[model samples]
Target: MRPPDFEARMRAGECFHDVRMLPAAWAVLRLDGHGFTRFTGRRYEKPFDAAFHDQMIAAAGRLLERFQGLYAYTESDEISILLPRGWDLFDRELEKAASLSASLAGSVFSIACGEPVQFDSRVWLGARDEDVVDYFRWRQADATRCALNGWSYWTLRKAGRNAAEATAALHGKPVGFKHDLLRAHGIYFNDLPLWQRRGTGLYWERFAKEGFDPIRGVAVSTIRRRLKVDRELPMKREYGLLVGRLMDGAGSGDSRRTA
Candidate 1:
């Protein structure tokens, strides 16, 4: 129904703001729950909930499988997925990449939890492998800080303090003060589960599989890779070491080509 000139004008206007990620850089998509505090508070337990954790894991697994991600890290209500430098999904369009990641995460989580949920996504580009490692390390540190604060705040709330009171109590308090506050109530932040503090990371690991080849009439061994989920992540420098090793392996695999 439109004239030829109209179609041309529409295309020109629409493509003006289209932005793509740099082709040589790796991409990381970080998705965070939208208004999940109220959403989960009414449906699950406080501070930490096993059911919520399970749902997040299920959704993360689905994303990793669907996107062919190199790695995924989740903590609290946030997930970070690492995409290889050569990935060209949606032609690496920034808007498409962010929207699709958020949509996939929200849909998967909602389906798994049987409740409507939403997530917002942002893309981070890294020019070097070390940048990726540092990004995750930064996120892991944030997870640790959030875990401490959550435990401390919820402990006060459970003891009859309202939200305002809990917030006021934690206001301007140093990390040591928060630790002491939790310790006074018989809770040790360090004693919490590693996943609760350091968050969970998922990556692929290669393993050998033994199988029988009927046509060849012989037993065969194949090297196959599968996702490895690590809940008990190491802390600080050790965690950085782990991330570095994973990045190194991925880089090596990316560089190798079979003719």
Candidate 2:
């Protein structure tokens, strides 16, 4: 969460243990092509990465203030979000966000990519508002998996591998993608998550054995690991926004966990 007024929330002394159940949450994924690397390589080669970067940042700021949720922008290709419970019109809001992202990105890289764009496709994962913080922590892992899958295949293709060859390499990996689709002007999955830093995912647990419900001990460990993520996830900004909203009632000693 961003700089929160924990002291003020705690001063009220409301108990979080027995608070009423929170509403369901909706996930919104924002996808975009990366930067200006491809354009520079071929044509003018103007060191315009900085200019494009600023465009993205400004567009992000404009978009965030206009929407609601656990919002965050990835420097690379996507923004992952969460809508709090009670936001009855959440799905509609999500579509609006998608359109807005596409419009903004298109304008920013119009000359280079030759098109304004956001994600080619998107996915959604639902969660409860109360578990929102942990949800993102889990999602970053999943998103890392998603972005890595796409990037790895793209790398293979760029290195002279074909569709068949790239697909084979990404099998059993985190997030899978086709190499040809990602070879646009500037974005690659690897560039965003820096997969090299995280290494190939280990699949710490597979859902099949227990399905939606996990074994108690393992669940605790997973939650603990997610809650303690020192690294930033795509939803941190929105997480802060929601937490700040909830602080209205939660005491300083409320259930909110400080990072």
Candidate 3:
């Protein structure tokens, strides 16, 4: 075969497995930090760390901007970004979407934290509005469960319990037991920061920018967009409503009106 013909034959095999997302479906790209337990154990406080939380928020914001996401949630070294139905990034190719997003998140977070990190990505396609809401609600529920377990484990370890002992103390324990375990140590799970229990949310907001209009010779107020970091987020059904509102407003390019 000629050189041009040979190249064309190889390209066909390279593109054979590529897949694209449905044009009418919503996409949630979830990126999770790889080997983060050891990564954070070396650099951050046990149970919860504010600096790490802030870094995650920064990374999530970068992703939201790059992907034009409608909403983003971060908790425990993972981020889930909600992209609207018509999102056409990378021509909606699943392989490109997953790999590029993961690479970007790892790079942004590593720069912010001053350490190298890696992230793995996956896409969740939702066929309806309720599917998206339920997806986030499920993630928030997991966040609450994780916070309870972490606080319980670290509290035990701080009080002289070894690794195995701490795990034993919390293994198969009920939620009430975990809550009481912390209470006995003067740590109330409910009083911990909301972000620890419910995770943080990032979305867009619009503000008025004042500038002089050269042609009119008068100051003009123009609406501009910025990312808003939300450390306080609602839980359960209320959170579902928040997601629904964001989804509805995203189509109209009016995420600003969602308070």
Residue range 1-259, candidate 1, lDDT tens digits: 5799888888798773479989979888899999998898899887888788878877777777777787889999999888877888788899888888889999999988888899999989999878988899999999999999999999999999999999999998999999999999999888988888989988888766677778867777766677788899887788888877766554223221221
Considering every candidate listed, which one attains the maximal lDDT? 3
**Span of 10 residues, lowest total lDDT, candidate 2:** 199-208
- Cα lDDT for residue 222, candidate 3: 67
**Which prediction has more favorable lDDT, 1 or 3?**
3
Question: Residue 130 deviation, candidate 2, in Å?
Answer: 4.3
All predictions: root-mean-square deviation over Cα?
3.1, 18.0, 3.0
- Candidate 2, TM-score vs. the true structure? 0.39
Clashing pairs in 1: none
Worst 10 residues of 3 by lDDT: 250-259
Instruction: Please give me the total number of clashing residue pairs in predicted model 2.
Output: 11
TM-score of 3: 0.94
lDDT for predicted candidate 2 compared with the true structure: 0.43
Give one digit per residue, the lDDT tens place, for model 3 in 121-153.
999999989999999999999999999999999
Evaluated at residue 115, the lDDT of candidate 1 is 82
**Ranked by TM-score, top first:** 3, 1, 2
Each prediction's TM-score against the native?
Answer: 0.92, 0.39, 0.94
| Poorly placed runs, candidate 2 (over 4 Å) | 1-58, 68-70, 83-114, 118-127, 173-259
Better of 2 and 3 by lDDT: 3
Model 3 stretches with alpha carbons more than 4 Å out: 15-17, 250-259
lDDT per residue as tens, model 2, 1-259: 3336776577457453233223444444455554534634454312223444444444444443344433434443444433334444434444454555566545645644465444332535455454545554454555555445645665667778888987887676543234334544355544543322221111011121222324433322111211111123224466445444432322111122222
